[model samples]
Target chain A: MSNEQDSVSDILEDNTYKYGFTTDVESETFAKGLNEDVIRAISKKKEEPQFMLDFRLKAFAKWKTMKEPEWPNVHYPKIDFQNISYYSAPKQKKKLQSLDEVDPEVMRTFEKLGIPLDEQKKLANVAVDAVFDSVSVATTHKKKLMEVGIIFCPISEALKEYPELVEEYLGTVVPVGDNYYAALNSAVFTDGSFVYIPPDTISPMEISTYFRINTEETGQFERTLIICAENSYVSYLEGCTAPQFDTNQLHAAVVELVTMENAEIKYSTVQNWYAGDKETGKGGIYNFVTKRGKCQGDNSKISWTQVETGSAITWKYPSCILQGDNTTGEFYSVALTNGHMQADTGTKMIHLGKNTRSSIISKGISADYSSNSYRGQVKVGKNASNARNYSQCDSMLVGDKCSAHTFPYIETANSSVQVEHEAATSKISEEQLFYFESRGISRENAIEAVISGFCKEVFKQLPMEFAVEAQKLLTLKLEDSVG
Target chain B: MLEIKDLHAGFDGNEIVKGISLTINKGEIHAVMGPNGSGKSTLAKILSGHPSYEATSGEILFEGKNLLEMEAEKRSLAGIFMGFQYPVEVPGVNNAEFLRMAHNARRVSAGEEEIDPLDFDDLLSEKMKTLGMEKKYKERNLNDGFSGGEKKKNEILQMAILEPKLSILDETDSGLDIDALRVVAEGVNKLRTENNALILITHYQRLLDYIKPDFVHVLSNGKIVKSGDKALALELESQGYDWVTTAN
Candidate 1:
């Protein structure tokens, strides 16, 4: 078993990042810098309304007054903001009327990534908004979605068609100045998906967005907003990948969800950005994201399910604010870090109304020299009588070099609230692997079985198609980390 | 169908199994009884191809194939199974699903089509029923949160599912109650076939009473001091291992 472990570690040391190929397409990029002029240029480039510009200016002003947070349990060299290109997009001759008008090079790039945007190979039931670099290149099933009274398109298109709706709920959930990354995203976010499910209606099909970062030095700041009206339900998924570069790239994204009376929103993310060089950890995406949802009406629900298996460094906390009586909030996450990667991610559930409830299940798997942590908070306010919260965080360490940590905070001002938190740290033992082997299962299959079991609770929350893909993605990421 | 010659195995530069020679034929059940630290378990580990336990100098042949040269999983796929004394608890892995995986591994190795979940479920249900295991065992995690007796039963259930040609039961009867002991022994008895052999490593003669052994060997100080029929087990139980070790 020890010999096998040694060989496993050796293989992991040589594990390659697969999605590291850059697309060959002409791109229009901004000069490397950040300032008021850059914010104005970005807003102007999108041809936004005056209110949008005002929003960006406000966020930029707030961002100037704030500083990058360093409290997360990760370490990296200081980021020179002025050295990163704020925006980059593939050059487009004109607005695309259909997938046929998409550039062949960009289409081939997406096809290579297993996300075909062409009509002949589009995902059957998933309406995808494929964002290339800094702009959405194509949005499939828009006509079908519109017939069902559902609004699904890029945020830039939504701003042009329905500026009032965008203005009303853009930063309502996560404020413009909520955090450093959120503020930056608000100021320079190029393109992301916008979803609006009207009252008394469920989405006809699953809505998803595939984000691809091609340029080496450009920063990707995409914004996603979902609005579920009264008695409505919507499930949204997002997947991201980036080309490998020797210089680290920045990806600061913001996602907000608004659920009205009796509405439900399910948001899932499978982030597989290029995770630098396995041995040197030279280049990868710095994923800093802020995602939050608000249960604004009674009996509303919000669920967040995320699988983080990429990115060199990740600092994200998808949270929920239960502000309505009898509302529910749920979070399920599987964050895996390998080969010099570091991730500090979890959720926050704030119970602010009577009879509010929340459940959190987080599983972190760390391999090689990576670091994985689960930081979560559950807060019940004085008015939140009968509030309940249950949190369980488990970590699995693959080798002796990797590390895992859990930080859970629970605060309740009301005595009637009930909060339960359970945490456990486990290792993939040689004995366990031997047990599987003695039963005829190979070591690789043994590791996969154990990992899938560890992440079962979280994977079950994902949509059917995504659950299978997520399982494969996890196996691919941890392929050589263990025997 | 299994042969071990002068197997001197140990871990961390310390030889625990000084020298063991044994041959098991089809339809034969061999019982090895010894006190603590007598290397009974080490022999089982060496046979199972555990990496930590190195065979300093030995030869193990299973079906005329060099077993020491094969990886643990390859050894298993070649019709060798080991029932661990302490079954590992794999949380969230469904027991039925795990059984199917192991069974499918063998099937694939033998160039057969994998059995679907529905058919596998029926087969597993029948096996569990024969072992007196409750239906909940199918849905529960593999050996996770299972009691001592339940863990032992799960090992046997896996053995029943895989149906390996040679099974080395390393203290499968340990920590089992009387009722559980009977169920386990009956389960083993039903699995016995002319094409398969069983090696039961035990520290007590009590297990021998339930499932009679064709050959009983008394091991002391890493060497088999006495070898005989089932009567030797009764003699050892009555006179204890003191007489055999003293005479040797």
Candidate 2:
């Protein structure tokens, strides 16, 4: 290795995860184990109907028989599923009458996390559902949405008031038997945002959710579902932050989206979970999430954009089921793992209808001793004649100790399928750093600029409010990788 | 403007520069002509505080401050700029954004306000016009796929925008044709004032034909062995370095 690379590697080794502070609020924490009784208690605690209870029971049974997946290019000690607590909700959580009724403490925490609760204080026209611990504390712009025949509320509330919509769409894109983590999420998901845009009416505001995992020794299982009727359009974004802790916390979330004919949905997330410390890799969130969207009708569209910079270990593949003719799907993601963080994330596109199209652009960055990988698959069904899929996955490494890997799979049963795959792996050259530094740019800023440039394409796809946020987050996460 | 005393440096543990020392003055242009592997590039890299070139024994004073004690960027902020021979290709970084950021960095260090994007565009356009660069170059990635001549022109353009007091051009004329060399030299010449100095490191005297140098120094093996007027560069261009290296 070059002398410069050696020093950069040393510099990267000294960085610690910054957003690791635990809130002292009391939570109705569950017992540190998983079972039928535990699952039933969670369902009952949420006041879910019998069908939801039965669904949880069946999912729990299925989860019990399934084994943990180990195919991802990541390494961690085996997760003790039974030892993990299934739920933890803030004790003060209750049906909030208004945003003013939200606990002042929760409001303060969100403010410190850079999430604004006051509607007028928001930088963009986004309606946020702030989820603290295991419950949604406040959801903004609900009355205005209701005026437009739009349904935007907590999924738990939707399950109670709009049970049919919840039942018909929940687990439809990502079934309970989808994977081990998805099955577990289906059984014990506490609360998440729900959105239903009525036909032919565009959402007046960008819907969003801000999830904060505050307590220790608890797992967060949130199930989010979005349904858009014909000719409707909605753009949604989600952000997450967690405090530092010594013990690893489990976060298994399931998000599903359904769009009808001519409907469009744009979903984005900027996740900065508390990665473990720098030395021993202790006290980080283990984020295993299952997110998928389905184009259920002709000419429908769905786009997923995410910037993941945190989590000790992340295994997620936000996918698209292109089931409608002439429908289009997109996945644009930038996943950066610094310190000892490990992330194996990408997306899957399943083309099932004639003339369907999908595009994937994923960028991964690894710094310090972290390992980041991109595992993606593109599939074309036999009847999906003239289907087109294009994917490009790139990885960037900052230090000599880090590693980047890319694994892409393409399976086409039809002969007319048009699929393109492009992949590359690179390291920040010392010459590049020197070139910037020689012009009065600090080493950290130079590194940040290079990375921001690498992720320009994906960042432009994010909501205007979050494109700048994602850029700043990437700089903070990789600042230590340069001297 | 700058003083270097007994500078000895190299990569890893081997000393590529063995006790080479020289002093530079404001308003003066010093051309250090040398062959390949004569430690010319090493000197430039060391002056820029590149992590690779370790200075074992040296004292470089820039405006009465110990230049070696500062980091690379601090040295830059203190008015030292290196016009790289082979400019690094940053693929996705836009040229206009990169120049604006560099401009803003100096401004911020001087406690001046940052230029807004709209105003920065005007300033960048003005500079590009002065350098005879195309408007589309602003949108292109920073030297990513630029030709050799274009890359050299970019270095000079950066030097013009940064307006450093001490500029070191390391073989900035190596790959340029006559017209590009003249354009690049004109940009450097336009930026030079009585308060600034220039160090042009080159192998051939072709660039010196355009950008006149006040003093010419011959560096071989590691240290400067000959110091003369611009006539020395003209002599070396015809007779080559043996006339100097063998003379010593």
Candidate 3:
């Protein structure tokens, strides 16, 4: 890299790694390995109910029988299950009551990430849950949320407090054996955020969950379930961060969302886990997640937006099943891959009812030796008469060495459905850069402004806080890769 | 206030501009007329510090500063602007916002008060009106779907807003209609003052009719072979550039 590019990379790395802090919290960690006995031990440790244990054992059996998927367009060394620790939770998490009771080092990590749980409490408009490793340390805005018939708590606590609700909806949409990663998540999942919006209610504020993975050689298995009742609306945001390491880590999560009649659910993610070395590609997270939402009643809507700029190898496709007539779905995303990163991310819009409609806008930026792809599918069943869908997938390549690809699959069983898909791939032109530089803009600033513009459609879909962070992350990833 | 001494510039040492020298006073407008491949655009690109053009041996003094040593953006900050023949399209970036950024970059370098959004809106509106452009054009992406005339007008609008000390218009009037040419010339004329100079490089005399130049130079074989006053443009129009080539 040139000296100027090196400086740019330094600035980006410094900003993105602000939350890479290590805490000294006492923790109960499992041994580094995997087996049926280990899965049974985890079930016993969680003190899970009999049916839940049976469900987990069945998932484990399925996972054991299934082989790893080889169709993600990613390359990596074999993942030896015996080398990965399945569970680790901070010991102080059991004693946490309020934001003040949380560990200072852990709280400082949130502060460095520009999210102060105490301040969020004061705002009274945002409910926050901070998840470290396999446990949720603190949850705020509980009182206000409780007053409105809303149930917002950790998944572990929710499973204990509301077993009936959990049993009714758990694994209904995205079953344990839905995919390889989802099956793995079902077997040894530890903790995640859970939210339920009651009927005839408009959620007054946005709820967010910030996830951190700190333990070495361990995997984070978070399961998020959200149920929005009839005429209810909720917007939820998820943020993830991890410290730098020279050894590969694993993250397998499952997120299931249900929206009833006239209900709307907006789910956004800002994923910024640590990426491995740029030269040797020594370490980073191998994130494989399955997230899906279902519109179960008429006039319901689900919108999924994400900004992904981390992980050495990322494979996630948050999808929507439009089962209700006149239901709507939208997915806007900006996925960036730098250094030795590889990302294969897009959404599946399944139109199962009449008059269903979906729109997708995906923008991918690849720099350095990275590879980025947008793999999307739109399926219109025969019952989905007159369904309408529009998709625009664009990829921008920063350097000559990087690659971007688009794989769009469209299936229509109903001849009356309207489907239009557009795809484009382009690189930054020398003339364009020269034009901007000739107008007194620096090279870095010019590139940044251009990228920001390219991602404007997707960034506007995120919440205010995540939008800002996503913009900064975009610049950081682009700079680091080019440098 | 610009001087070029024995400029020898080319791409990959082919020497498109063999040896050229010229000087322009602050308020003067000089028109360089030549046939195709006569190195008129090459000279303008070199003046604007295009990286593709390598100066084999030359010295460009802008306000008594060594212009060749500075970067392209720094040269722009030092008061130089070029209206390209085919302006670039920057998708998803609002035209007004980009102009404001460029304008502020220059202002910040000059130790002047930077322009806020409100002030910039006002300034941009007035300039658009002077260029006879619609108000709604500001919110659209920069040159994304602009026609040939609109693109040239937009370039002229940027020139008007930037108001650089030295402005080079390379074939800015190539695809413009009579009315666009008039409005563009008017915008250029309004930006001209005692402190700014203009270089209008064109093959035809149509643009010079609207904004007369102090000197008209006919370039042939990478060198300016003849120089005259305003009438030379009309002469070249009545008699094609072949006349200058045959006379030489």
Candidate 4:
């Protein structure tokens, strides 16, 4: 059995450096910079409404007053926000009415990321909205989704036809003044998928948004808003990947979710960013984002599951605020950091109403001098009587050079609430590896298998497409250390 | 056939198996009996290409191939299987799914087509019956909450399904009752063939009573000190490993 693990680990070690290829997409990227003019120009290019202009201006004002958060346990060279291009789009000569009309360059980029733009493309049994840089390039299986009265489209279009619905849900969960990145996202966000499941409806298909970074020096700021009306159900998955590059890039995005009475929302993310330089740490991505969901009505539920395996620096926490009686919130995460990358992430479950419940399971893996941390807070308010919360955070270190930390904060103002937290840190055992290797799995495949098993709890939450991609992403991040 | 030529191995630079040499031909069952901490498990691990065992000096050859040079999985693909003393539990990975994956990995490496789900189901059912396992065991997580005996039986089931040329059982009877021990031994015996080889590592002669080893060796202080026919196992069973440790 130990031999089996060793064999599996060997297989993973050889194939771990994938997702390092850049696509030859014909993109029209702006100059490397950001300012009031850049923000205004982006809005002008999108042909924004007057109200949107005002919203952008207000968000910019708030962003100007907000300081970059220093609390996250990540270290990257100071991001010169002024040097990042705020907008970039592919060079498509025509407005694409279908996948055929979309540029081949755009299609190739999606294909390279394993998201083909073909009409028959089936990814993990979910409909995909492949967004490259700042634009939604192509959508898959729209006709089938439309049949269920599920509105899944780019946020820009959602603001047009479903204006009332968008207006009501937008900024309701994550307001413009939520945080530094959220404010910046509000000011210059480009395009993201907007999903609306009508009352009493269970979406027949899983909705996904695949983000790819194409041009250099461009910051991809996408804002996603999903609303599940009363008695509605929806599961949404988001996946992001970028080519290996030598210059650090910026990706700041915001995602907000709202679940009304008796509604349930499950959101999952698989983040595989290029983890810049392993030697000098010259490039990669600085991913700072805000994501939150609110249970606004009684009996509503919100769950967040994330598998993070990439990026030079990641500082995002998808949280849930239980504001209604009998509401439930959950967060499950598996974060892997290799090379010189660092990730400070977890979740916040705020119990504000009576009888609210929350559960959190966090797993962090650190290899090759990387540092990973799981910092979370679960707060039960005074009115949150009879609330229950449970948290389990575990960390696995692949090598002696890496570090994993767990910092959980629990506060209960109501004595009737029950909160329990547990944490454990361990390394891949030599005995475990030997057991697998003897069974004939290569060392790399064994490590991959073990790591994959370590993350199974969170990976199962991802959509089929993202799950495969996540597994591959983890393989790449931990490949070199398997031996 | 397998050959160990003066193999010196250890962990963290501390020698566990100083200098050991052994050879087992096809269709033979070899048993190595040792006391606790006598390097019995270490030898089994080294044979399976475990990375921790730094073969300081020596070589292992499996079927004319440099066994030490091959990766763990390659060894398995080359018809080597190790039944663990204590199996690792992989949560969320179904037992049947893991078995199929392991089976297909070897098949692919051998340039053979993978078994489809239907074929796998049939193969699994047959093996399960030999190990006294129910069909439902296939869907459960790999040894997630399996009892000690069940885990050992599951290892035998894996060996039966894989049908490797060389099978290494490391203390497979450690925590099993008499009934479970007999069941596992029977499964091993059922899978035995002229083209296959078996290496059983145990602390007592009780398992030898069922599997009936062709050769029995006494291992002490990281070296095999005595070798004889099956009667040697009975002598050790009557005397004890301590006697052999001091006799050497």
Taking the candidates in order, what DockQ does each have? 0.65, 0.56, 0.47, 0.35
Alpha-carbon deviation at A34 in model 2, angstroms = 1.9
Give the runs in model 1 whose Cα sits over 4 Å from its true position.
Answer: A1-15, B177-179, B220-226, B235-248
Two-way lDDT contest, 1 vs 2, winner = 1
- Model 3 CA deviation exceeding 4 Å by range: A1-26, A119-124, A442-445, A480-483, B5-21, B33-39, B54-58, B106-119, B134-136, B175-183, B203-206, B218-228, B231-248
Best lDDT among the predictions, by candidate number = 1
How well is each residue in B1-248 modelled by candidate 2, as lDDT tens digits? 89999999898898989888899999999999898988999999889888777888878899999887777888889999998888889987899889988999999999999999999888888888887888877888999889999998888888888889999999999888888889898888888899999999999998998889999999998989899999999999889898888888
What tens digits encode model 2's per-residue C-alpha lDDT throughout A1-483?
A: 144465566655655455566667767888889888988898888899898999898898999899999898888888888787778876763566666766677777887877778766653577889898788888878888999999999999998999998988888898888899999999888999999999998999899999999877778889899999999999999989888888898999999999999999999999989988866787789999999999999999999999999999999999899999999999999999887899999999999999999999999988888999899999999999999998999998887988898889999999999999998877777678888988998777787789889998899998776898788788867766643
Q: For candidate 2 chain A, which ten residues in a row score worst on lDDT?
A: A1-10
- Candidate 4, residues A153-174, lDDT tens digits: the string is 8887777678778777778788
- TM-score for each model: 0.94, 0.93, 0.91, 0.83
Candidate 1 C-alpha lDDT tens digits along B24-64: 99999999998889899888898898888888898888999
Clashes of each: 0, 5, 0, 43
lDDT of 3 by residue, A18-133 (tens): 55556667778999888878877877777767777787888888898888999998999899888888888776644456677777777777767766777443445678888888
Best by TM-score: 1
A306: Cα error in model 3, Å: 1.0
lDDT on C-alpha atoms for all candidate structures: 0.91, 0.88, 0.86, 0.84
Those runs of model 4 whose alpha carbons end farther than 4 Å from true positions after fitting are A1-18, A22-34, A91-103, A118-126, A139-150, A160-165, A442-445, B2-43, B54-69, B83-166, B169-226, B230-248
How much is B89 displaced in model 1, in angstroms?
1.5
Evaluation by DockQ, superior candidate among 2 and 4: 2
